[model samples]
Every structure is written in structure tokens, then in C-alpha cells.
Target chain A: MGMKCIGIDVGGTTVKVGLFETDGTLLDKWEVKSRKEEDGKYILPDVAASIREKLAGLGLDLKKDIVGAGLGVPGPVMPDGSVEVCVNLGWHHVNPQKELSGLLDGIPVKSGNDANVAALGEMWQGGGKGYSDIIMITLGTGVGGGVILDQKILSGRHGLGGEIGHIHVRDDEWEHCNCGGVGCLEQIASATGIAREARRKMAADSRDSMLRKFGDDVTAKDVLDAAKAGDELADEVFEVVARYLGLALGQAALIVDPEIFVIGGGVSRAGQFLVDRVFKYYDYFTPISKFKAKIGLATLGNDAGIYGAARLIL
Target chain B: MGMKCIGIDVGGTTVKVGLFETDGTLLDKWEVKSRKEEDGKYILPDVAASIREKLAGLGLDLKKDIVGAGLGVPGPVMPDGSVEVCVNLGWHHVNPQKELSGLLDGIPVKSGNDANVAALGEMWQGGGKGYSDIIMITLGTGVGGGVILDQKILSGRHGLGGEIGHIHVRDDEWEHCNCGGVGCLEQIASATGIAREARRKMAADSRDSMLRKFGDDVTAKDVLDAAKAGDELADEVFEVVARYLGLALGQAALIVDPEIFVIGGGVSRAGQFLVDRVFKYYDYFTPISKFKAKIGLATLGNDAGIYGAARLIL
Candidate 1:
């Protein structure tokens, strides 16, 4: 029998679970709507049940060949495998490792911050293959970062090593973050922040040809489309975004100095337009960096989350 | 015979050397004025002769029990053990390891960045004893930094990992650095930067300051003395200096996450006043860092350079 395990990726709205062989081939997979009704206590057992049902359909016995389980939660994990906080799940100080381990009949369960797991997943089976030092930045609703140093996830003393979103980009006039910080890199560079800045900028004056068409429904995608159509305002918006992001990347380089940076998320679809702006500004800020590192798009896409979670089992 | 080795710390104006046991116990140590007339080329032979004379006094033979030699130069060390770009010594690329090895009649020689060797020395015998993860910041004329992560010095791919002096503190307003960068933390927080900024601020307006009493000969020490005497400008200078340093340190903590920060150099003599201010601002920036690691003074002082160089032999 092949060595088998279960990998689960817990997101804000849905939970993705997959059964994997020791070599990282996905045997089977399943998904379920995350517990959106209650305070998340109602969904714990449901997640376990969904995994068991999926495994049973594949004629796999959890007690025998399924050696262990791995999970990627959407927040910081305590060293003891407990969830310290998750804004989406509204969880604080909840020990997900103990809960999952007990639910799986004492099978070993490992968990980490979601972004870190994704980077690991990318390294395991995606674009970051064979790279020992890598950084994965997910540009979703918010910016999330994972740092892999010396072939291991650098989950700082309290498992908060990969919180790239909170790094300060603007010195003074930064948007207020949910974490109570101001001018965080995420506040100006993340998709949510970009959209917010655009909306604020648009409301101040309705002069742009493209933004004027959207009226109140201005979205990040709209900005991308307008830029694709050569809208000056949309291009300027991205230029500012990329400048801030590039500066933050330069600052981060002073620390991680990783071999490569993998850019992911929904906004990254803008491709070279976004990357070019970022790289152009990155050079102006990286004066003392020693190594020549490259920035590349994440090749794994949404599968990265699932793939990274699965890699935890190995 | 027990294993023995010689360590030499070559500075612009002075040469400090020591013979030590493999375990870091100091058998003997000495210092001499360096001969800068030969463009620093003849300095290595002088160091080798001094070490041999010391060993001979102890009735020791270098060709027998002595294992090897190590050196710490005040600049970036190329991977092949050459010193590069020492502005003080006016050296571009000098092979100190090869030169010293030749002087020792074929004894193997090892070399590293001066600050890095100081940190290694601390880990081997000073305040950083027993800690594998440490960052040593020397607060002298210019701030110097050395990082030891997982028992290895984190020399970035180009041998500049611990250039803490160059970390960006102010946005982009930093004047040109001797290293050709702007806004480097060293340009604002270093003793040189602090004194320079202070003199400029004082000279802008003839205020009632002890700084005026020092005339144009003002130094960082004068500002510290005035602050000790309760001069508001001097006190404010310290606050400004500490805030910049604290912000830079908080940024460093986000990446390296060292267990302890060992601070050295002459400026560190400001003692608790500097440490207290840096700690106050450090906390403001690192609200998410779980480990509230302590910042302490470097215990080894000038000997650290020689001790750290000796450490490379082991």
C-alpha cells in the first residue's frame, strides 16, 4: 500500500481537502462550503465528516494507510498547533490541531499559516520547485506573504513570520489597517487597498474617461480593463500601486534576501504591466541588497493553496 | 600538544592580535600601531611577526601544535577570503587570507567581515554565548551589523548580509551615503549621522545650546553630554536618533527574528538612555512580533574583533 495522507486547506468561504500519496500526487479531492452560519463552532465536525466521506468513496481506510493529516488555516498558528487568530473565521485562541487530531482518531496533524503552506505547496509541486529560498506573495483581497528560508518555513517565534501585509510602505499617510496599523504596504498595494484608493481618488473628481463610466461600481478589474484600453488614470493608479509595492519589496529584500519572489493572487493577472512597474521602482529602493534576486509570477494559481496544504503531509 | 591558533584584527590605525585555545580562552593578547605607509600591504607581515614573537615568548612552535590562522578586516570579505572596498584602508580588493597564509609560511588562513567576526566572537565567548541566532550591531562612527542565523553567518550571496547600516529608515530624503545610497539608516541613526544632523540643525539657528559652546567641534559625545545636562535640543536629538534606530531595528526584527540583539561600539556608552529610547520605539513598530527579545550591550568590546577572527579558525 502506498503511503497516503489527507491535506485540507481552510479558506474564508470554502474548505478544500485532498488525499495525497507520499510523492505528492493528488489521489482524490473534495470541497465544502465553510460554516458561514454560526461562529464557526458548528463547522468543525462537518469538515471532518466531509473528509471521511471523501476518503470512504475512494475505498481508503483512515485507520490504516492514511498515515497523517495536514491543514492550512487562514491565520497565524501557535507553536502548539493552535489557531491564535483568524479574521475571516472569527477564531481566537482555538487549538485547531488538537481538535483535528482528536477528530481523526489521533492521527498526527500539522498546521501552519495559510500563506506559508501555499509557498511550501508551490515549492513542492509548482513554480518554486527545487528552490530552497523563496518568497511567495499572494495579492488577493489583501496581501499575504510566505517566507521559505533554508528550505524551511520561517514561522517566527510566534508563527507570525510571513505577515508581509503589515510592513509599512508609506511613512505617514497610510490607510488604517484592520490590525490597527496605518500605511501598511497591504493598505496601498493589495487588491482591496488598490480598489479603495481608486474609489477614493475617483470620488474626489470624476475626470478620468474610464473611471467616469463606472460611477459608483469602480472595481480593481475595471481599472485593469481601463489600463488595458490605455486609460491614463488607470495606468497612473497602477504606477502608484507598483511604486509602493516595489519600495516594500526593496525593504523586505533587506531582510529575507531570498533567491526569488513569487507573485500570486487575482490582481497578478495583469501580468507584465504590474510586474514591470514593480520592478522599475524596486530598483530605485534596493541600494544595499547583496544578491540579484528575480520576481516571477506564481504558476500554480488556485491549486497552490490545495497543493501547499497537501505538501504538509509529506 | 593542545590545539592553538592566532587571531588578528586589522584596523586602519591599530593592529590587535591574540593567541587563544580552541575553546576561546585567551592565552595572550597584544596591540600595536599599524603601518599605513605601505598602503596596508606590509601590515599582514607585521601582524604575522608579532604573533610569532608572542608565541616564541611562550616557547610555542607555530609549525607544530598551532592549527591555523584567522583574520578580521574592517570591510566586506570576498568569499575567497579577500577584503574588498575598505574606504578607511583604501583597499579595493586585497587577498588578506592568501597574504596572511603566505606570511605564516603556508599555515591555512581564514577571514571574514570585521563585524561578522565580532558577532562570531561574541557567540563564542561574549554576551551572545550559547545563542545560535544573534545579530550584533556596532554603534560606532557608522553602525555595523552582523547576523548569525542557525550557527552560520548570513553572508548574503554577495557578502553583504549584515549591512544594517544601510537599511532604509527615512523615506527617500537621506542624503548621499559614502556607499552611494540614500536614506540609509546609517545616514541618520549612526553616531556620525547623528552628529552631522545635530551640527546642521544647530548651525541653522544660533540657539542657546551647549552645542554652541563646543563651537564647530561638536561631536556625538558633546550631544550626549548636553542631554545628560538636560539640554532640550540634545535630548531631542537623542529622541530623533533613537526613533530612527528603533524603526530600523523593528524592521530588522520582522525578518531575522533573532533571539537577542547584542549592541556594541563607543556610542553604546550612552548606556540605558539609548537602549531605553530604542526599546520604546521598537515596541511601537513590532506590535505583531511575538518574541519581545531583549536588546543588550556587547560584552566583549574591542577584543571582540580579535576574538571573532580567532573563532574562524575553529
Candidate 2:
């Protein structure tokens, strides 16, 4: 049999594991409950056990068949493979690469930030498949980003290389962002930010629209849905979202000059519609004749982390 | 003698040439008038002749003593060592790298944008001397920039990686920038921008200050000098420059996260005082706890381009 690799995406709630061929073909995928007990000391052992059980079931030998493993963790990862801190996993100064390698019987292991790996996965097989340089923006609970230069993740000096969510966009914002800054891109472009903006817009003036029907329980999805349904008020809200997103992206292009921008996350479910809106603003902000970064939606969905993790080992 | 390299900085009116040892010791430097006649066909030949004459005078052979050559042009350069266009030099689709190599008995040659090369030069032996990742901001006739990540110039997909001047910063700007963008960082943070803002501030109100003596003939230096001498109006003008420049640098940090930002060009002559002012706003915009990019002034001045170009060959 050809050599295989393991991909692990360690989230706050669960540990996603995937067995894949070196050619990126997934053979098996499963999830294990994350045990946060005792500073999450059992997490790597649990993952190792799960992989061993799966290999045994498939009659695979670790020494002969498995090549290595790669991991995607939810925190800043230093060049030395030690994580600075992960509030979700209760991890601090943990070297997952060394621990996982030791756990898997000295198999070679590598790791990167979850968002950065996901971007690598997308570049390897998703929206940024054909492009080498890319920036992936995830508008989930908070605005997250990953910068891929020359097909490698730019993890930066403090592992803050792709932290685009914190780019300040507004000057007059009164409220502070979760990062303690006011008017960050995350404060206006994230799913939470979109919902908050919807609520604020609704409160500012009584507009007759479908978003009003949701009352104070409006979500980003509802606002997107309402916009698609031709509601003027919700469309206005999305316009605001697109403006900040596009502006931030434009500014990012001035620095990295990626060939394409692949946008992912739950908010990307709006598809090409959101991509188009953001591109308009991106074009407006970057007036250089050579401004030619194409915007597209990510295709890997939830499995991007696993795919990216596997790519890391390869 | 040890192997030596040649660094060429091509400008509109003059071409600066430097001969250096592989270790970056500048042995000799000179300049030649740029001959724009005949579509700049004489530019390369003239540079090649100058280098040969200098080598002959030193009794050095091209094949035995010279390692390679590098060129820094005032335009975008593609990955294939070709320039898209240099309007200042009337160049279109020119491959200086290939042509120069042929001219120098087929020695290896490399080329990059002038601003990007300057950044590399600063990173190698100037203000960013000890840093591996840096962004060099040149606030001159225009706000030019070069991004150096991992000690190499990031000349982006279209060679616009460090084009920070075009980043849109204000939504209320009515005047169009040279690049056709409105409210670009260049329009607010550049030398011309500082002078323009100073004039506008002086005209907006009859405030008794040192700038009143210059009236309509005020220059960026006049404003900076007055500010340094405790002129409130001039100080206010510099505050605006600092605000825009700091905001742009903070946003740049979110993308590439360089270890240091080296401020260059004529305006940087204000030195540490200006650096301190810009840092204040850069700090306010980037509130991440791990945000730690230091700001400093470039030390090499004009020689940065030649040093950076030679480093390119090394």
C-alpha cells in the first residue's frame, strides 16, 4: 500500500481526525470528544489512541504504512512549534508537534495555526486551488484571516501575520472591539458584527423590512436572507458589511498583493453574492492598474482544516 | 581580491552605480546621466560601459572578480525579471536582468522595484539592520513602501506588494491621487500632502504663526521646521500626517506583521521625533497584546538602493 498521513484539527469542542493518502485522498475521517480535564493533558494521547485503533482495524502498520501527521491548533504557533496560548483548549506554551510526534512513536509531525492551515488547505484543493499567493478571510463568530505567500502560510513574527480581523477601519467608533481596539474589521464584518450592525440599524430608525420581523433576535443569516429577498433595509446593512470587508481587503492587497482572495467561514454561505459586493469595494480602494486579485468563495467547507493539516505533512 | 557585486539604482535623471564586495563593503560609487533619448536604448549600454571602465581601472576581470549584478528600477518587476513599464524611463516590457547579464559577459543578474530594493537595503545594513522582517516606508514626493518578509523583498504577484501609498484611508476625500484613487495614504502622509494640509489649515483660519511668513510658498520642510520650533498650526498639520501614517502602518501590521517598520525618504529626516509621533497612532490602532513592531528611521539614505540591489545578487 502507498504511504498515508494523518490530519488532526483540534478545536475547543472536539478533535477531528482524518486518514489520508499522500495524494490528498481521504480514506477515513472521524471525531473524538475533547477532554479539557487537567489542562488538556489527555488530548494528544486520546488522538494517538484513536489513530492506533483505526490503523489496527485496517491492518495498517505504523512503521510501514504511515508517513507522518500534521495538526491544526486554535492559537498562535511559534516557529519552534510551541503554541503561545489557546484559551479554548486551555493550552499555553505547549509544543503539539513534539508531543504528537512522540505519542505516535517518533513519527514526523508538523503543526500550524488552525486558520492558517485551513487557508493552506483551500489553496491546495479549494477556492484558491490554482493560485499560489492567497489571503483567506473567515467571517465566522469573529473575523479571522490567513495569508498564504508562495503557497506557504505567513505565520509572522508573533504568529500575528494573518490577524486581519483586527485591522482598524473606523475612526469614530465609541464601543471597543473584543481585541480592545475600536472599529476593527471584526467589529463590523464578522457574523457577530453583521448581526450587531443589523440591530443597530434597526434601532437607529424604524424601517419597514423583514429584518424587523426578527426583532432583536436577528442573525447574520437573517440579514443575508432578507437582502436576497430584496429588502432595502437588510440590503443596506449588507452594503455596510461589504464596505468594511472590501476596504480591509483592499488595504491587505497593498501589503501582500496576493493573486486571489478566497473568503471562507459560515458567513461565506452567502456565496458569490457576498464575494461580488466585497470585490466592488476592493476594486475602488486599490486603484493601481495592476490591482488584479480575484475574489472567490472557499470550497473546502468544514474539512479545510483537515485537508490543510495533511498538506502540512506532505 | 574577494568576489564583488555591482548594484545599479536607475532613476529618471541619473543612474547611481556602486561596486561592492560580497560582504557589502562599498569599494566605489558613481553616477551617470540617464539618456532617455531613443526610448532609453542607451541606458543599459551606458551602465555596462561604466561598470567595465571602473573594473578595468581597478585591474579586475568580469569573469574572475565579479559575482553578479542587480538593478533597481522605478517600476513594477515581474517574477521573470521583466518590467511592465517605467514611465519615467520610457521603458516597456524591458528585461534589464537578462540584458545586463548579456552585457557583462553572461554573469547572473537580478532586478526589483526601486522602493522594494531600498527596503531590502535597509533591512540588510541600515535601520532594520538586525531585523529579518521589515516594512520600509518612504515619505517623499509620494508615499512609497517596500515589504521585506524573512529578509527578502515581497515584490507581490504584480510587483505591487509594498505599494502602501495607494491604500485608501479616508472616505471623505474628494481629490483624486496620482494613481486615480481618492484619500490614499500618499494624499495624507506624503511631503506634498503635509505641505498641502499646512496650507489648507492656514487658510481655514487666520491663526498667527510662523507659517504665515511663508504664505503660499510654504514647503513640507517649513511646516516640519516650524512644528519642531513649537508652531501650533504646524504641529497640527504634522498630527494629521502622523494619524494617517500610523493608521496605515497599524493596518499593515495585521497582514504581514513585520518585526520593524523603517521610515525613509526626505520626510524621515525629522528622525526620532516623527517616529515617536507615528508610533503613538500605530499603537492606538493595533491594540493586540502581542503587537510588537518597532518603528525607526532609515540610516542608509540614498545608498540603500545600491546596497539592496547588490544584496539581491548575493
Candidate 3:
């Protein structure tokens, strides 16, 4: 007697789709190539067609098999179900909820920001399982995060809440951030930022290192692997990047003080070593001893966004 | 029939007490000399006797007239109602809620940190009135603040959730903050910090100013008053202090993104001038153009703690 729900996580390159039981059991999962044609006009329709085909293939009917659906958009989502702006999806001046709801024949679609959706997913069944208050940071191409307090996401009035990546962690920064800000935490904590720091360090120090030959092709993974291999230069690069990340996190701890911090994104594949390094600086920067937020790696990985989206409506 | 409740704001020097109706109407208010002798052994007992005498004078029965009592202590309060430490009250490892509950003859008592309680009070009837999500900064002898999201205080796991003063905004600070941190927001935003900055300016620049004559007797009020008089030196000092304070606040906006920021305490008395100055820098620091958090002066002032404490039980 269980019903199914569709979860959609909209990304820059593709859309992740998951069919799940109301009890959070994943029945099936697939992907849809995100066609940015006509300013994302066909995206929602494509999603609806995918769900309808899936339902027909499984011999399930709407209203009987699926009650509702949720979406995690690659942009800031207002509490009123409107998308402020989505640079990646060409989503501008759009209300995804109302638009998608009409397309789905009033299936009661709910939407949230992708990062916030991922956080809700983590809280629901990922690394933040059994935890209500949490902050999850994704350190892939960029540093993005979501905050959950009192069992609900803090989306803020203008959809700017949980924008932890943009907090100014350095005062001496000379370069401009993508957000037009100076010295944003994202500049030093993102995977791209790690590689940039490593490149700068190698250029300045003239040290013997495994990354000496890679030059501009060096990735954040290379830095982590070299550090793991005990390359002194790579380890030093790791420590500097980790220090800034920890300071930003430690400052956040002083602000919201969540129960646990769930680290995710492609860069988090470095695993326990990254968590341990971030926590070491986090502990030193945080003043109080009794207050400690447990650090854990994301268990859901790519599925976190979709699960969080489904949970948004569920 | 309006039932009365006693709201207590426990500070280091004096305890501000208020008699309020259950619906939040204040009937009367008074202050008591805080006798911190012998590790504050007599403090609670003294408060209890004072309340009993007041009730007797009014011919009110405890069980019939008073429904609840709340205290806002000047320290972190655990969920179980214990204060970890209170430097001013000489309290260490004391259960203020339990001790006060017993002293008041089993009357229901609830407590919270003074700043957290103050935030609740502001949310209830002050600058944050009708707004549940808010951040209130009290720039008194030290910089203290409280954060409320989704209509509840985030006291945190270690009772350190709302310690906004401790966010490290500067990396080059030479002197240590009272909390042992370097270059904390409190070191530049508090009244003492402002005066300290003003003193440093006076010592460094040979600018002829009214503050230079006052020597170490200069206060934050003096600097603000001088700036109001169009003192060039005072304006420069105000600019620097306001810059740091604004940067710290801008960093916070990126993190919590609350609906409003209530500025209170001694320094806030500098009034609209200070608020405008902060907003000027806040706007420059926040990345998003659509994002905005309304700034307002705290209306409750010193009585905010008592009202907030009373709110705990109400």
C-alpha cells in the first residue's frame, strides 16, 4: 500500500532523477540530459514525460502510485516557491513550483535550492541521519553549503541563507571572487581553489615535488594524493587550504553551532583525511572546549540532492 | 484577570528584576545589588526573599498569583538549566534553574543566556517585533549577540550558539581578547573596543582633537559625541571601527541571513548615525543584490533580558 514519489536534482550539466517509495526506499533512479534550449522551457516537460513513461513502464498510474514530486533547482529558491535566479539552468523570472505543478497536472511539486536540498537529504538519510541541526559543505567546483536548525532549512528572506561559501575569510585577498566579492571562503576551500593555491605555492617555493611537472593541469585530487603520499610541498599546500576552510567553519560554529557538519561534494572523495585536517583547525579556531560539532563524510554522494528534494515535499 | 510573573536579568554588578503579567505587560521593575560574596551562595536566596517580601506586600499568594518565573543569566545555560560559568556572579557548576526552582518553593522556572534571552525579548516586542528570525547584537562592555531562526533561539549544543562577539574578523590583531582569541569581532565592536581604538588613534596621529585632552578618560560615547561635533579625528576613528563592525556583520549576513538585525546596548545609543554607518558597509560587503536584512534599533534596552527570560516560561 506504499506510494511512490519522484525526486529531481537539477544540475548544470545534467538532471538526476530518482523514483522512491514514500518510506524513502529507492525503487529506481536515472538521469536526464539537461537541455538548456529555449531558456529551460523543455526541462520540466522532459521531467514530466520521464516520470509518466516510468510509471507506464512499471504499470503504475498517477494519483495511485505517485502522490507528489520535488525538485532541487541549481539556484536560490524563495520560500514562496519561486526561483530568483539560476545562472546554470538559464532559470530567470520563473516560479518552478507553479510552473511544474501545472505541467504535472497538479501533482503538488515542491522545490528548494540545490545545496539546501542536499542538506535536507543528508538530514533525512545521508551522513546527517538522525540529526536535526546540521550544516553541510560541498567543496567541488565551488564551496556551497546549507544550514538546518530546528529540523528545518534556513533559506533566509531573500534566499541567501546558508551562503556560507561567500563569507570573507581573508582580508588580504587581491583577486575577485565569481560573486564579485573579495577573499570569499569559496576561493580557498573549493577544489578549484585548492589547485590554484597549489600552483601558486609551487611557483613561489621552487620545491621538489611530484606536482612539479603537472603545472596548470594539477587538480585538487592530485594535491590530496600527493599529500597522502607524504610529499612535503603537497602536505604544506593541504595545511594552508585546510586552515582557511577550518577558520571559515570555526567562525560558522560560533554563529550557528550545529550538531554535526556533513562534508560532501566531489572533492570530499579525499575522505577521512580531509575531515581530520579540517577538524584540527576547526578545534583550534573555535574558542570553547565543550562545544564540538561532529564531522562526517556524506554517505549519499550524488544521490543526496534528489533525496533532499523528495524530503522537501514529503 | 492578569496573572503576574517575575523576570530577572542577572548581571555581574546588579540584577535587574521586573514584575510582568503573563501576557508580557510590565507592572513594575527594580534593581538589586548583586552580592557575589562567597561564590554567590546567598544570591539565589536573596532573590527568593526579595520576591517573597514583594508578594507579601501585595497580598499575593505564590501558587494563586504567580504562574511562572524566568531568569536571564550572564553565562551559557545548558538545556538542563545549569550554568557552565558566570565570571561576574562567581557562579561555577551551578544549576540556576534547579536552585532557583527549589528556592522559590517549586515554582516553575526557566533560564537562558542573557544575550539569547534578550534576542527573544526583542523578537517578542522590540526591534524584531513580528519577526521570528533575527540577529541581535548588544555592543556593551563586550560584544554579545543572539540568533533566532524559525522563531526559536539556537542555544547550540554547548550553550555557545549565539556568541557573535567571538567571530574572528581580523587576522592581524596583536592583543588577545578576554576570551583568549585574537582579533575577534568583539575586540573592535564593543564599547571598550571602540574607545580602545579611539585611544590608539589619539596616540598615533598628532591630530588635535577634543578626545586627546581626555587622555585615558575617553569613552565610546566621547568618540561618538566628538564625531557628532564634526571632529575630523573622531570621524576617522568612527570609520575604522564601523568598518570592522560592518565587515563582521556582513560576514554574519552571508552565514545566517536573518530577516532583521537588532542593534542594542550602550554603543547602539549612538543611534541612527551608527545604524546607517553599519548599513553602508554591510551593503558593500554582502554579495547578493537582492539580499537585504532590515536593521533597527533595539527598543527594550536593558530590560530585554528580563522580557526574554520571562518569554522562556511564557
Q: Per-residue alpha-carbon lDDT of model 2 for B202-272, expressed as tens digits?
A: 99978899999998888888998999999999999999899999999999988888899999999999988
Q: Candidate 1 overall Cα lDDT vs. reference?
A: 0.78
Q: What lDDT score goes with residue B163 in model 1?
A: 78
Interface RMSD of 2: 1.0
Candidate 2 lDDT? 0.91
lDDT of each: 0.78, 0.91, 0.87
lDDT, residue B17, candidate 1: 91
Query: In terms of TM-score, which candidate is stronger, 1 or 2?
Result: 2
Docking class for model 1 is acceptable
Q: What tens digits encode model 3's per-residue C-alpha lDDT throughout B1-314?
A: 67888888888888888888887888788788889999987888888888888889888888788888889998888878888789889999999988988998898999889999999899987889999889999999999999987777878877878788988888888999988778888888899999999989998999799889889888999999999899999989899878877887787787788899999999999999999998888877786555789888999988898888777787
- Least lDDT summed over 10 consecutive residues: which range in candidate 3 chain A? A283-292
Clashing pairs in 2: none
Off by over 4 Å in 2: none
TM-scores for all candidates: the values are 0.88, 0.97, 0.96
Q: Residue A108 in candidate 3 has what lDDT?
A: 84
True-contact fraction per candidate equals 0.15, 0.88, 0.60
Q: List the residue pairs that clash in candidate 1.
A: A121-A308, A174-A183
lDDT of 1 by residue, B1-314 (tens): 58888788889999899889988888888986777775766678788888788888889888897889888888877668766676666666789889888888788899888888898888788888988878888888888888887766766545666778876667747478766678877887778887887887787766687788776678888888788889988888888888888776776666656777788888888887778888888777777654566787788999998888888888
